[model samples]
Target: MKQGIHPEYHPVVFMDSQTGYKFLSGSTKTSQETVEWEDGNTYPLIRVEITSDSHPFYTGRQKFTQADGRIDRFNKKYGIKDENAAE
Candidate 1:
């Protein structure tokens, strides 16, 4: 490893804006904003739009489009039928 050539890695606080969730981790990224964590230590604050707390996939709020509905609509318009349905 080389000395004095790498960005300084230090503790950083990532805050999820929507859920107000804060976590501490180490990173080379620096921010002008700082926050006092639960441990009473000040760390650089980084605000993010989406995190596991508010993400649809993580929260199981995912909505899937109805593929069968689209197929039925197309078949109704074009007068098409599956072989199983025709039989």
Candidate 2:
């Protein structure tokens, strides 16, 4: 490890705009804003669109694969399936 050549990795808060979720973690990134954390110590504040709280994958809100509706629509337009399916 070299000295004076490493970025300062400190605790910072990532704010989610849509859900108003806040995540405090350590990073080497820099920010112009700052906010006080639960430790009562102020750190940099970085606004992010997607985080563990708001991201679809982490929150289990991921989009499901569609396999029924589109197939039906295509069958109706091209007249490939039975007539009862059109109804």
Per-residue alpha-carbon lDDT of candidate 1 for residues 1-87, written as tens digits (9 for 90 to 100): 999999988999999999999889999889999999999989999999998888998999987876578788898889987777755
Against the unseen true structure, what C-alpha lDDT does each candidate score?
0.90, 0.85
Q: How many backbone clashes does candidate 2 have?
A: 0
Q: Please give the distance, in angstroms, between residue 43's alpha carbon in candidate 2 and its true position after superposition.
A: 0.9
lDDT of 1 at 62: 88
Candidate 2's TM-score: 0.63
- Report the lDDT tens digits of candidate 2 across residue range 19-87: 989988899987999999898999899998877788897888888787568777798789887756447
RMSD of each: 3.6, 3.8
Clashes of each: 0, 0
Candidate 1, residue 78: Cα displacement in angstroms equals: 12
Model 1 misplacement above 4 A: 65-87
